[model samples]
Target: MKLRYWLAALPFIGIYSGGTLAASTTFLFGLPFLLVWNLIWMAATAAILAIIYCLDTRDEAAHAGAGKGVEK
Candidate 1:
């Protein structure tokens, strides 16, 4: 949707895909542990994204209010 959302999501996607690829390859050699690690990463990523979204929305609303005030 928004560029901000896409930017925020890019890191998580990269981490998940990279982790999956690494786990699938012979570099890590651990499957179950890597899977669990990726799951934890996913959870952390979600939390970070939620926080970012909240902050961004707050900023955007403040900017919109400023613009409205300027128009008066």
Candidate 2:
């Protein structure tokens, strides 16, 4: 697999490991620790996805630019 694939998996790995770690902790601000942990991970996942999209878009644009003067 490519490096991008591994990079894409990072968020999931973080969520799983972080969640497991957070679950054993106490609550904060009267809210469940797990809830807060999951919410943070969700935001992180969104950011990661956005980064992946931007990278893919950039790659596509570069590829298109490179092919502009090519035949077939």
Candidate 3:
């Protein structure tokens, strides 16, 4: 797996840490802390996926260009 894939897995790391946070009664941004945490991680996952998609698209384009000169 690529480093980017490991980076993408980072959002899930927050889940294990969430048990400690569940004891808190505080609200985040007017929402429940756990809700906010999940939302934040969800957004992060989307952003990471978008970045991976863009990089893969770029790599594919580069590969396709390099293959254009082949006669067979």
Best by TM-score: 2
lDDT of 3: 0.77
Ranking of all candidate structures by their TM-score, best first: 2, 3, 1
Q: lDDT by residue for model 2 over 1-72, one digit each (tens)?
A: 866577699877876776667757888778887777778878988888887776676677888899889998
**Residue range with the least summed lDDT across 10 consecutive positions in model 2:** 14-23
Cα lDDT tens digits for candidate 1, 1-72? 866677687666756666555545552335455565676677877877777777577777788788765643
Worst 10 residues of 3 by lDDT: 10-19
Instruction: Indicate the worst ten consecutive residues by lDDT in candidate 1.
Output: 22-31
Candidate 2 global CA lDDT score: 0.78
Which residues of candidate 1, in runs, are more than 4 Å off?
A: 1-31, 58-72
Candidate with the larger TM-score of 1 and 3: 3
Q: CA lDDT of each candidate?
A: 0.66, 0.78, 0.77
lDDT for model 1, please. 0.66
Query: What is model 2's C-alpha RMSD?
Result: 3.7
lDDT of 2 at 14: 73
